[model samples]
Target: MNAGYVRLSRDDDKRNYTSIENQKLIITQFAAENNLIIDRWYEDDGISGYKFDRPGFHQLMADLDKDIDQVLVKDFSRLGRHNARVLLLLDEFQERGKRLIVIDDHYDSMQTEDDTIGIKTWYNEKYVKDTSQKIKRAIGARQKAGTLMIRPPFGYTRSHKDKSEIEIVPEEANYIKTIYSLYLQGSGYRMIAGYLTGNQIPTPSMARHAQDFAKGVISKHKIAIQWSDSMVRDILGNDFYTGTLRLQKRARSTVHGKDKRVPKSKQYVFENHHPAIVDKASFDLVQELKKKRIKSNYRSSHAQPAQPELSSPFGSCLFCKDCGSRLTPIRRPASGRERKYYICTTYNTKGRLHCSKAHLIEEETLMNDLIAYMKLCRNSLCKDITAYNLECTGDEKKTSVRKQTELQSRIDVLKKQMQILFTQKIRDLANAHGCEKVINESYDAMQKEILTQICESEKQLKTLRNSILTDTDKKERSQSALQITDRIIEMKTLDRRDIEILVKKITVDKDGLPEIELRYGLSHLIPCSPSCHLNRQENEIIYQCMNLILQSDRDYTSARYLSRALTDIHYPKSAKGVLPYIGLMLKAGILSQGSSPQKPYIINKNRFEIKKVMDTFIKNCCLV
Candidate 1:
């Protein structure tokens, strides 16, 4: 029995001589010429010959166990590309007393000792290797030419006319802009994802599938639009929207290994390769905000303790100036009033040895100071916003104005339709109970979608207007921001969300007075009051203890230790007598008690400085 085997590789060759039909014809002609009868034919199409995992090859091997006398092929290349696999198959056929013939190569495996056939097989393998190398070279050339190698990002698609370039999809681009606005406005990743999903916005995969189907790249299939937190995160993280394409991002390490992402340094990027959906400024801002979110991710996992103040309005935005770590909120009610104070995380958790100070600040005092500061700078902040707007105004004012009008018009129309739908639902309220679930879901989705559209249009308008703000426009924006701040300050109950939307961070100074930095306004440094006053003898003794405390180099010295050190330094004062000095200093405000387990008295640096300067002044006066 004789069988014919043929293969056609996608990239290797699809030309006339290498086509499946051509190979079949060549094999038939050779079989007829050689007077060999062919029984069955097997073929693998559009598959690589470098591997024997092809379907046709497997069928041929299954039939090899049969009483097959001969296997006919167009050439040694069609049998399989790998030299070793081809040689092994030839030897196996020889063992089975079956002749494997390559008609085009004029080779026969029956003569296993023939070295010429071996050379022909080697050349056939080289043809495949050469073809593969050429394909890789072609790709490298395209990459060098700044070709768009990836599927277009979420806000874009490949141009209908030019497959190599991306064209912005207006509707989809709006969704992308809304995502940025939502994040910048203080929405979390999961929040953004839920918002998109709730709005019934088509997921990236679903949108891509539809686009591909329309382009005839894919056949008709049910597209399940599912939005996930990961998908939302990817869109937020992608730099492609900034008009850059980074290609060859990931590759498998080896045949059996997992896919490994290539670092940015190793990636080939085409910057400004396409029209940006999100501007570089906005993109950069979002990236920085995302980085802060990542650093504070651990803070979110912390469950609120039993006290109300554990849930501070500052959240992770409160930082200890001394340790550069987040300040931990401690609930310590003084007298009967509930109070919360923020302290250095290092000092609170790892002890004062790790951090010299807690940078403690009363939450109410911090907020009051912040409010006072905002009121002080409100007018200047308004002017600054106006100046920013004016300087950042885009030159394409006419074009942007037209686009804004168009978008606003669409938004108005959608709103009207939604209002009509809502009215209809209200009118049909009696009959709506049975389908309430469906109706509510549809209504909510529609409402969110419309709101998303309005937000997107406004964002685009802002972008177009503020791309390059003029001096006059800056004044207008500053005035607008000032008005918003006025409203925020007037609110009776301010929460973390409210604060997060306006302030970038709250930096606590070493003295526990917070420096509240508005996102776009000036940073306000709250003045700290002196905690204590000292008398003559108290100043002299506390000054000595302060020196000892400074020289100790420990985080802080206990009042008991300071007393013993004072006794040694004062000569006349015994350790027993020094306890009264300690009591006097603690009462007179020279020392501050910490929340340490033993409630040890720590040196009050502010008061110590006050006494140090006085001591110097008195000594200089005496000398004079």
Candidate 2:
């Protein structure tokens, strides 16, 4: 059956010109002109054409089960403006043997060429870009005219007669004065925020929400009210209190979407553009004092110095074992000298009652300990390497032989399953139509699914049979790890780069005792056959992921924490990317869980399970 989809959004037009009624009328006319029967008319009112995620769209998608033969729309942009999303929807329709017609764009999915569809889709995307550029140019023109294009600063509000002009808010101005007074009186940003929070004074964000609520710009429910240290710092840094408005403090690129601070040379500073809450002299004085305090804080040592060692090689690798928060670098006055040490960030900010431990470990002490740890790791690897060196140049090739035999065994089982399906098909249709009758649709479908499985198993077996490693390949690959071990054994001191090569992360407890995690290269140590289910990188990631889950003391952990832990050890990884690794582990019975994958994983017999997995690597004499 043919269906029509129509949508209109306020962003398209404030007036009812692009209303739902108008779009439906257009679709109706198009269907009538083409002599097509409209089974249903789906309407999405007040929804953006830029996004496909609408209630009406989802309902129409669900109705595909009713055998929708064709979909008609007023235009391609009405279907959706985003090129990639709209194209994907078109592809889905094509795959299901459904036709799509866009009247205004003169595009028909069944009749139009791929490149023609692509060009029309490109035009739809370009419309959004053109609109964005126009708005940006308008803003630029206003900026050149010294017009205030941003929201009112902390102690000010938009003028009653002129919305672009700033006016002093008497009540908020008093708080602004108090903040400057406190800073001049030697109060830090943290203390200032605390004082305001303790007194029940609304923060800048809360105050802005209050103004927005008064003007009916936003609903009362959205007035999220809170005070924080960063807010106080932002208020203190703003020079708007001195009757000067700053513009272009930060710039965001259209291509790369991250905001970066515009250099001082490029930033525009307009003086005396707003009502004064603080004098220019006071603002300048506060800025100078801030500079001095920052310079003092960054110094190496104070008074009598302890024996200086190399600077902290570990940048953000160390963490507090108890809270899992990073160990922030701090210099504390100790026995008439400044000592550089790391403390748990949570305890440093929230106090001991929250974390119950400072986790204070000096950098020099941690550095020396790390050096010793690397040496110990190198020695252990060297012993393993020596044994592997004595082995007969990979003569038996036990791992590849075992893997090939296992894959062949799986293929045998799949072949048997196929044969059984053949027998079942014969019995199922023995006398359905006639003696020469073909298998029914149900049996045919079953056969297809089984055939796919059998093909995959046979392919895996073929790959295993072809991928054979010789004795020389093993010795050559093992050389790099052996060289690294030998180098670490001869080294007297270690730096940050050296530490990165040896360790992944370092965890320290409340008592300053440390636990180091070595980055053992599993892919190189236990090489996979060319036809293996996983590649070298995937195998390494799987091994590391399993170790992280099993080694943790907690029985369960959120997907978020697992992803973050991996990211902190490696690159900036998100929870979604780690799912495949988790799937692989689950497939091999190396990891187990009782809850949903979205929920926390409950590692069952984690120690025993992980040990069994590691035993496989050891049995293969995996060392490279």
lDDT of 2 by residue, 299-398 (tens): 2222322112323456456788999877777766766977778888889999988899988777755765665555555555665666554563464466
Candidate 2 lands at a TM-score of 0.42
Model 1, 1-624: lDDT tens digits are: 889888877646545357788788888888888787788898999776777888878888887888667788887778777788888888788888777887777777765556777677677678777776666555564554446656776779887685754788999999998887766655666666766777789987788787887777974656657667687789888998986777767755432236789898887665555667776657777787678868865243223222223356776677877778888777766658676777888888898899887687767656765665566556545677555555555444554577667656866886787798788767666577688778778777666655655654454445445455446545644555556677767973466546665677777766555666666535442222111111233345645654665566555557567656776775333344355556655675556676784656675666456466546745853422
Clashes per candidate (backbone, < 3 Å):
20, 0
Worst 10 residues of 2 by lDDT: 299-308
TM-score of each: 0.52, 0.42
lDDT of each: 0.67, 0.67
lDDT of 1 at 216: 77
- lDDT (C-alpha) at residue 544 in model 1: 69
lDDT of 2 at 221: 43
